[model samples]
Target: MLHNRVPHILKRLAAIVLLGLACVAAVHAQDVLRVSAIPDEAPTELQRKFAPLGKYLEKATGMKVKFVPVTDYAAVVESLATGKIDMAWLGGFTYVQSKLRTNGATIPIVQRQEDATFTSKFITANPKIKALTDLKGHTFVFGAPSSTSGHLMPRYFLLRAGIDPDRDFRTVAYSGAHDATAAFVQSGRADAGVLNASVWDKLVEQHKVDPDKVRVFAVTPPFYDYNWTVRGGLDPALRKTLTDAFLRLDPRNPEQKQILALQRTVKYIPTQPENYAGIEAAARTAGLIK
Candidate 1:
């Protein structure tokens, strides 16, 4: 009788342990979806803009959404590749990098309508700088070296126009952000600078940068740009859910409209890996990525 009782006690303990393991697995499955974006703007501004979107996503997906801010552009790519984050808002160039690093395991889900035809602006405080060619022999600043509109495409177009920024410019500086690039030029630390046209326009519209001090001297031809990318191994069902949530944002709805406007987008549209081929090609041409 004692032997039989000992066997029963062991079986009961094993069952209890399995039950606890199952509970832990269930809780992990419902863990909060972590999101992050390239530090293209001030961290404070990114947090402010993403807060409402996170709440909206939480309601849409029935999962808590937390917005994580990073210190630089590459951190977003690294986070997505290592599965540290569920999704990220990546510039075209950064998307290319993540795709390469993950061996195409990162997937693009959605992009703004504006992203399909994004452009960059070359700005300057000096009247003598009339064009990209004129930027030669003068100090110039670019936004983050990894930036698509702020650095990559702008450099690509400059090279196309026969101006090699590294060799031709007297000095080159990186401002780390579009607004900072404008401020750098305005403050005379740099004679000319380049940044995303949307950022430049916003700065002008907000009167954050005086028009008289800094003005657009050139605009790069349009190209594909920012997008929401997810890690490759995400459950297909969840990926579709995330994509659908973005598409559901209606500009006609005031609340959704505010979210879209804050993102500088008209509406979110589904995107595929092929959408970034041109961007990848541009990166290769610029020798930014292998």
Candidate 2:
């Protein structure tokens, strides 16, 4: 009877052990990398741009990669703070908001080479608006209100030029995206508009907006703008893996080159919170932050 009881006990223990092992495998299977970006472009375009990069990230990290889309810039910041997402693509001003909202828990890990000196272009279809000063008494449009290149820095520069957008322009509008800002001006909805140079260059390169129909009104000087920020408590090892993957995107390789072109970057480099100091300062000065 004792020997029979021992075999039955052994069988029960083995079943428990197998259940634990299966649970571990299930947890590992659920370890997916969640990523998101600010809605700075049309949803479809952003999806198209991120497709190759997502595939590349999954292969590089040995984890399933998922792209979470947000409706607005603030949604990206909120998602990062609430831990609904693990990482995000954010503009400089949006990064500042996230850092503050998370009590400095968000980390900007990598930025494009061109991000070090990002610029905003003020474009217009109206021939009368040739310069910043000329925008007075005319309807003007800006990209998202929280945009570094499209709004905050552009507004800061406008104040520096003694042109208050709110007071100087007859009407001010938000186009919500760089491409839309160009369209607002081209369709005679607004006399002038501003957007990131990246999207502006893309529009020109793609002939999406005729150069003659919509021309640059003014170009802002260089400033730090966009970066890929991860949540504060992200695993260090995984963070390093993410950093290394972006750094490894070499333009010399054709496959990587296509990814870079889609991202509009020549290469990616390590970045830190300090790179966004001036952006924060500019936002504060522009009254976007209190």
Candidate 3:
């Protein structure tokens, strides 16, 4: 009986050791490349769009890549600053916020060709609304406050045109995303709305928004926008590998074309932190950040 009891205790101890080893292995497996993007669109749409791109990155870097989507634009900036994520796709203003929050530790790696000259489109259900001044005393909607093309530049241009959204509009609402802003105007929730041009074009192309109802009344001047940003202190070699992978995507290739079309980019190009200086200044002027 003593020998049998001794064997049972030994077996239990061995099992516990094996379990500990397995836990460590699981953790090591999870040491993957974590990626996320600002929720500029629906979370589900973001996940669908990123699935193929995540696979392509994994194949390129020889590491498992996971795409995480956040509900708000600020969350993406905060996650990148806190190192909760390894990399992020950020808008110009979001990148500016991350840079300031991280004391200029955030790095902009690549941006879409369209991003270099991005613009915002103001749409309205009211046919009489033909200019920025026409929005006065009408309900207005804007995308996420942290969005560059969606909110910052749009508001900046509106002010430049001598129309203040907050004061002039009967009601100012935040729609949280570009698509939602269009929907707001289409549904009569808002008399007019502003959003990124890329989303607006996509919506028009896909027939998601009826051209007969909501129409673009104004388009802001070109400005720098979205980019792929990585956390500071990342391995230099890994960063290079990631950047090269993005730059190597050939839009002519069938598979790569699908990804590019989904991303609304003709190609990805190298970008620097300096490209967003104007955006930072705009945010400061708007009193969005100190």
Candidate 4:
């Protein structure tokens, strides 16, 4: 009888252990704040840029912050769509694509102050390519096909200027990244190329690319651009905490200043889906999204 009671006690202890494990598992499920950005810039540069921000987010959200790097623009969108990432830095076109992909389940929470009126630049080493019209019969490269500054808005402007990229250019190529677009034109891989003005400015600032070698020939009109967006089904409280953290990134603080400078923004501001209406319209007009 004592042996039988011992067996019952052992079964009871196992059940208690299993229940404790389940509770710990449930608590850990959302303990990590996994964030990623579109591969707009080089991977090394992106990592350098996100390092400070990741630390800042860890303090802000009280969760372990991790930067999940993606390989391309579409991967960012897909990651957000499938809940693979909690948040992402998305260009306007990519944001629209993600929102559409998830059936309007993503939220554009905040953006760099300049994103409200973002612009793109067309660059070239060929002196002959002086204007949008001069691009005729020349090889042209664009950033990722899903890029707002690199492709969609640039194409929209080119079309508006009566120069169809597909028909007018001798060749059309996708460099897949802004830095690569500048390199393509500077190295003569393409006669001309276009990239976001932010990247072009950064490259010039960093002396990474010679401005004289790959100079801007044209600039697209301003449009809505990049934003920090959260995936759908995120806990409303966590979403608010994240949004508040971004909104409250005070540049007066040294740590926050580093984060802002690395992000290439003076300050973060509240953003809404409505701000990107023009972007959605542009993607539709450019036939990038149905």
lDDT of 3 at 205: 95
RMSD of 1: 2.0
Compute the lDDT for candidate 3. Answer: 0.91
Q: Of models 2 and 3, which has the larger lDDT?
A: 2
* Tens digits of lDDT, candidate 4, 1-290: 99879989999999999999999997897899889999988999999999999998899899999899998888898999889999999998889999889989999999999999999998999877788898999999999999999999999988889989899999999998999999898889999999999999999999989986778878899999999999999999999999999999988999899899999987999999989889999888888887
Minimum summed lDDT over a 10-residue window in model 4 is located at 211-220
TM-score of each: 0.94, 0.91, 0.90, 0.94
Ranking by lDDT: 2, 4, 3, 1
lDDT of 1 by residue, 83-132 (tens): 88999999999999999999999999999999999999988889998988
Candidate 2, residues 120-191, lDDT tens digits: the string is 999988878788999999999999998888899999999989999999999999999998998898899998
lDDT of each: 0.90, 0.93, 0.91, 0.92
Model 1's lDDT to the true fold?
A: 0.90
- Report the lDDT tens digits of candidate 3 across residue range 16-117: 999999999967864599999988899888988898899999999888998877878888988998888989999999999999999999899999999999
Q: Which stretches of candidate 1 lie over 4 Å from their true place?
A: 1-19, 22-26
Worst 10 residues of 2 by lDDT: 25-34
After superposition, candidate 2 runs with Cα above 4 Å error: 1-26
